[model samples]
Target: MFGDMMNMMGKLKETQKKVEETKKRLDSVLVDETSSDNKLKVTLTANRTIKSVEIDDELLEDKEQLKDYLILTLNKAIEKATKINEAELAATAKEGMPNIPGMDMFK
Candidate 1:
């Protein structure tokens, strides 16, 4: 029983290391999104950092429209970032798991 505890602890540390590495890499993963009319563009990191934004000249004329487009673009950018983060996590989860569906929550 003692040996099992030590082994589990070792694996937990290893998994923690992998997760940290994955998170670091995720911080640099970028996703670009545009509004439905392609008037606004936003670039986002998987860590939810906005790296860049571009808006059409027409959008600059109307404050309300620009705000709406900016919001739409930001939301889409966040969604893209989330999907990438989930994919990276799933890939990380494929390495040396404990064969338990809920095991990752412990990490």
Candidate 2:
């Protein structure tokens, strides 16, 4: 029983390491989003860090419109990045989990 516990602990440690590595890798995974009219564009990493924002000169004329475009586009980009981040981390965690009884519910 103690040996099993030790093995499980070791596996968990390995999983933690892998999850960290995956997070680092995700920093390079870019997600792009654009406004419906193509006046604004955003780029972000799977880690949800904004890398760049491009706006058409037409948008610079209207502060409110630019704000709305930024909010909508950034939200969409964030949602996409969040999905990628969660899926990747969950998959990594599940992949490294030891076969313990009654854990299938998590799947």
Scored by TM-score, the top model is 2
The C-alpha TM-scores of every prediction are 0.84, 0.96
Question: Residue-wise lDDT of candidate 1 within 1-107, one digit each (tens)?
Answer: 78877877787677778878998999888899988788899998997899999889999999999998888789988988998898887677567455345666644
Local lDDT at 46 for model 1: 96
Pick out the ten consecutive residues of candidate 2 with the lowest summed lDDT.
98-107
Best candidate (score: lDDT): 2
Model 2: CA > 4 A from native: none
lDDT of each: 0.83, 0.96
Q: How accurate is candidate 2 locally (lDDT)?
A: 0.96
Model 2 per-residue lDDT at 26: 100
